[model samples]
Target chain A: MDGYKGFLGLLVSSLLVGFLSVIFTLIWVLHYREGLGWDGTALEFNWHPVLMVTGFVFIQGIAIIVYRLPWTWKCSKLLMKSIHAGLHTVAAILVIIALVSVFDFHNALSIPNMYSLHSWVGLTVVILYILQLLLGIFIFLLPWAPLSLRAFVMPMHVYSGLLIFGTVIAAVLMGVTEKLFFALSGYSKFPPEGVFTNTLGLLIVVYGALIFWIVTRPQWQRPKEPNSVLLQPNGGAQEGAGGLTVNFSNVDTPDSKLNHEASAKKRNFTADEVGQRSTM
Target chain B: MDGYKGFLGLLVSSLLVGFLSVIFTLIWVLHYREGLGWDGTALEFNWHPVLMVTGFVFIQGIAIIVYRLPWTWKCSKLLMKSIHAGLHTVAAILVIIALVSVFDFHNALSIPNMYSLHSWVGLTVVILYILQLLLGIFIFLLPWAPLSLRAFVMPMHVYSGLLIFGTVIAAVLMGVTEKLFFALSGYSKFPPEGVFTNTLGLLIVVYGALIFWIVTRPQWQRPKEPNSVLLQPNGGAQEGAGGLTVNFSNVDTPDSKLNHEASAKKRNFTADEVGQRSTM
Candidate 1:
């Protein structure tokens, strides 16, 4: 458990900063800007920041690290994966609403949409996110994929998930810069509102950095599934006939000794648990 | 070399897009804005983007992956480490120059400094980059640290390196947004300048993403040093007396099976080559 030494501390810090970021965003929009509203006004645009921080950045951060929560290791991986996907699903819906708010606000003010760098990167993050969500469900949630295929896609899925998260933070930082300049006339002079929002932006970045730090630590990863159903090399064709195909790519590195041991002891694992076999 | 497949293609793509981003930044500054210069002019501000993209983003990207270059695998690791550190040093110098240019321009126009979100984040990246460089040299480059200490710092070093890179991209994206809005008269209307700059911003994101993707792939990492000098566990206190203490953090993950193999065979490996031993 040497690896897990700082895990809890980092996890707590991540949660602290993550929620604090959301709270700050809410404070920025509600206190500094007009309070949130649904009407096609500038207030509607405020929803974009609030929703994005809550659902897109903060919730997405939680989803990325949820599997690493040692307390949750007792739960079935299928349940964990479901929760992961569910969080993502919620985030996607919030993002969509946020986007709708932006477009509505733009139309209300006759401001052109998709014209700034923030919009360009923000839109890309959105598209990539939804694609990642759908792909995660299809390959990981469904039991139809072959074990090998699932294994192969797992690395890319994990990498893209983290990358997308990083991009989300980047896009939000850009969005913040845009909003500050557009909303605050004395931004250059660092008025109270400007300083508060600037601090908020810094908090967002710190939140992201903390999440990235916590998730990438090798020692903090979930232990390998105790009872995975590994497929036989000769039984390739029957992989997806009705059995589980868990993605091992995320749970263990390609060079893990535990991975080799699992492969050697493949026959011992139950077919039903194959979908849960990950790092040890 | 199943892992090495597509590595070259990806490396080439990273380099191509990385340079293309710099070129586009240059075009945006020189072709769209005034040409670069010194002597406290707005044109001097152009160096801020140009130098940052070239050195901070592009060269830093190259530095991060230099160890992963298979062709360099044949070279002595000490040489490779030096080259890696050397590239980072070059990048640090360029970033410093970029900062100077921005400050000079701001001072000339009597503009206050470090007020904007971009400046806050950019300065943080700068400070962190310098700290990382210095720490890497102290713990990695110098032949003084104990193996255990080196191992402990390696994960953090790698994680911070990537996080800083991501932050750099985020900071740059914000810089792009700020510059476009300030410089372009009709950014909202999608003028030619606005379109080109926005594309430039997107290209920068693509470059950073490619670098992230390439560096994170397990297959693409450099092979372990053929003859590393390992240390005895009991001989830890004498580690930095005169021999090397190469960092394995960046080269191999903690979960690597080969690491266990190496540990079991620790007595057989020459201590001189321990600094070089990485992944197979």
Candidate 2:
């Protein structure tokens, strides 16, 4: 079950990321040609940031989806444990790639000293993503962890995805319009052919809606049963509704009849033999 | 209660709209001054579209909030209904104002024939916004309508807001950077107040986030109890330990003794009851 879910997560993430990357690349190329007059030198320099960030976001998405899947069902502990480690490793690598790209751009482009603030702020997002990734992995490994831990991790993944996606989109837009990296290179004045970025944004909106729906669904369908193990010690009653059984003789004594009547009222049961049935 | 809520809603809407109008007016004055030096005209025509749209959005927002207030709670149905009708009248007036502004701009602005498509698109948005204002007023009159109806109204509001906001932001950026409008007038160069337009884009992003949060938070919390009328049919029997009582008594015979036995074995009774029973 774990393996199947993990693979499914990987497949979905890959498809989304791959499609987004192709769109981003095409936009960058088009923008390069129109804005820069098809200058080859300008094109080479402008492509780095777009390529690097797209790659980082793609990998980071895979890591997040993998970490989130186990919550769908119970799975083998070993499988859960290994996937948890694997997600973290991928996340860390993506973060490192993001960091290296930012630093390399800073050195290569000689971006204005004042614009360093943008770079620093962008780096902060990478750091936050890495921290969220680590925490998610840790929570996944803890078998007895509360559901809230998983809940908390999901939002971090969402917010980080937004930050990363927003940053890259902004960078690409700036690159297209301003020729920020290569003054000689230019791209299309028009928007890219594929509306993937807009679609991706829509997808995020849908994902958020789904999360809200799942979290708030009514709980009345599942009622909590009593803890009978403490009373029986040997866990003896195991075959009735949700492993519970009636023991009528225990409540038949005259002294207990009033108490039993109150219980019967609460359960909406009229006094009858069938209610006395017990499981093994 | 309805009157109070309506009053509060009106107050909030008025304040927000008034404040946004002032902000838009101030931006217009500033941009007007910048555009005047080039055109030798007292009023700069370029700022008109942006100022009009901003003012329109603020007005629509006011109409939406006023229409949604729980006014039936506080007054006689006749009075509440009258107030609802009055609010719609005010919203319609604002829509008329928006329509006139769009038509005025359409007549004034001249572009290359190739750019006629852009102008048509711009006019389409204005028409859509006017339609939305009408639809919003309609929806406000019928608050008890299906969720799907409310859902349908929202996209018109959102998409129109986005289109107008996007156009104004893009125009402002182009005007500031290329001095596009200034070139047509006589201005040499303009300062980078395009950053302020970006700041306005950020405000739209913040506004979108807040709206998304408001719409989705209830879904994230437990679905609200299907309104009072829906609940009134059921006898107010508290379900189990919670208020959600689902009666399944018809599924099987009511067996009092057996029910008591079941409840006793399951420890369904309160702690105080157990103590009282022990004494008995």
TM-score winner among the candidates?
A: 1
TM-scores for candidates 1 onward, in order = 0.85, 0.45
Question: At residue B206, what lDDT does model 1 achieve?
Answer: 86
| Per-residue C-alpha lDDT of model 1 across residues B160-246, encoded as one tens digit per residue | 888898999999999999988777888888898888988988888888888877666433445444433243222221111100011
Name the lDDT of candidate 1.
Answer: 0.73
lDDT of all predictions: 0.73, 0.33
Here, model 1's chain A TM-score works out at 0.83
Residue-level lDDT tens digits of model 2 in A219-275: 111111121101111111111110001111111112223344334333422211111
Runs in model 2 deviating more than 4 A are A1-24, A27-45, A52-280, B1-25, B28-204, B219-280
Candidate 2, B109: how far from true, in Å? 6.8
Candidate 1 Cα RMSD (Å): 7.9
